[model samples]
Target: MLCIKKPSVASSFEELIPKILTEGDLVETEFGERTKEIRNTIIEITNPKLKKVPEKYPLGEKAVEEYRKNLLYGSKNIFSYDYHERLFEYPYNEERINQIDYIIEKLNQQKNSRRAIAITWNPKIDIEVSKDERGSVPCLQFIEFLVRDNNLHMTVVFRSNDALLAYVANALGLISLGEYIAEKTNTQLKSYVHHSVSMHVYIDRDRDYIKKYFPEYLKYIE
Candidate 1:
């Protein structure tokens, strides 16, 4: 378990990656490279607005609907009760089954409830680990919101996080959620506690991915 306490002057969350990835435990997956799992890493960010964004995400002012569907909200298409008889399963529904609505409504109603939560993984679709045809399973598992001292704090859990591609993007999405909930519940954004069970940068047999992508991985390593 990695419990890293960053100083207030530490900048972006990405800057703190090398500290864990370079010193964590290694485990081989059926996927490409051996992943470095920090297991249970709880790193604190001084600012809720984590100021790091990757080139690939490229969310212009966070208006990308596609990213929203994948991150905070699940697909709008969902199965109805009659899904068994229909040939075209996974039908469309008007309401999103994600936790954003629950968060907003419950937190607005009762700020002290400990159940303002959001879940991303659906076990019916996510059970197949070997099936690449299932678009992509969610890397983030769950996020819970708590209010302490009139401040809304978020705790994010990730099953596996790509330190290069997904770390900051996921945090940004959560920050958006936190801010939205905070505004609705009349609270201030306090802290973002991220616990990634497996945070890694993928590398090929020749270490080409990181060599090409993370040229300055050690840039903020202190």
Candidate 2:
């Protein structure tokens, strides 16, 4: 039920942080976790307004472009893909699956299908207790897409989501995915619904920064 609608990334990121902080639960993550205090939460972008990104607001142009480049590929960058194993590294295996292509094909064939789910978490790979040394395991769990009334909407789920840095970018990244599929499916991009079990600002690291940023964003939201 925590949701916000913004016309651009520049405008949206500001709004998302506050929601995470407000709606988030003060929980602690498991051992080998990066930070101390965590906020487990959920967020929804009722309207992504991808139409205003880059060209219009641009936000942090250089940074956003770098991020955009990393995410645009069908391959992995700091993000994810490949039930195709597109990434050369990671668990260091060869088998793969193109989730993007799979979802696109599913929607192309059946517009009303609920079977359009693409998952990134592998129980064997992700839950390996011996692989504790690995730096990245995946915060993203899966993404589902639905088309209704000629509009394509996305539901994004995450096992652990970073509140400040990763929250907005993750939403934007998924929005990009939804946009791509919508174009292929010939539907309008409606919105993005985001659920993060851990949508938290790392309190020990970001408390001061988060507090400072809040009042400023508060005014903007007010």
Candidate 3:
């Protein structure tokens, strides 16, 4: 019997994780069977105890503020990728780097308590890895994060997706990224996602495969 229950706002994502662990059955997502495994891991790390749920799961406004404070004061653990480069890319152009510096300086100049954010999500410019490519895999990537009251919230971006086949992977990726950023920045990460409309074209075609392994996946949004 499936005993899964939805989480309440009073509890954080961490608190909900255990319900997923003990009461929740692994529901298939577009991504694949791996979703269950990853979800299980997230719960294990967030809430070690299933006894009493925490008041805040850390995905709150204040949590996001803490994270930004850390980024401004400590290391910025930003991760990026370049499909064309076939590896992680660094130093977003000199101009971009300069902008970051400028923002930092401006924040101090104005004596402001907020942070500046720059994202990489232009499909036209960002390189995509393709399957037919003789040398690399075909994929799309981008980043998204939240900022409230000038405090940087959690950010999550992704590379590659099977809108129907691997939707779970995408969700897990975003959620995990939010958790990590929240932990590092000491803030809560609000969630958002961007996807290709063309993905539907492919997903519709693979309806059979999706239904066979991921029957519960479609129930996600429905």
Candidate achieving the largest lDDT: 2
Provide the lowest-lDDT 10-residue window in model 1. 79-88
Query: Could you tell which candidate, 2 or 3, scores higher by TM-score?
Result: 2
Model 3 has an lDDT value of 0.35
Task: Give the better candidate number (1 or 3) by TM-score.
Answer: 1
RMSD of 3: 12.1
Off by over 4 Å in 2: 1-16, 19-25, 31-40, 50-61, 74-94, 129-134, 215-222
What local distance difference test score does each model get?
0.59, 0.60, 0.35
Model 2, CA-based lDDT? 0.60
Question: C-alpha displacement of 84 in model 1, angstroms?
Answer: 25
Q: What TM-score, over all chains together, does every model reach? A: 0.71, 0.73, 0.36
Tens-digit lDDT track of model 2 for 129-169 = 32665445667777889988878988877877666666555
- In candidate 3, where is summed lDDT lowest over 10 consecutive residues? 40-49
Model 3, stretches more than 4 Å misplaced? Answer: 1-132, 135-138, 149-160, 201-207, 213-222
Query: What tens-digit string does per-residue lDDT give for candidate 3 at 50-74?
Result: 2232333223344444433433343
Cα lDDT of model 1 by residue, 112-169, tens digit: 8899876655555556632764346667677788887888888888888866555665
For model 1, what is the C-alpha lDDT against the true structure? 0.59
| Residue clash pairs of candidate 1 | none
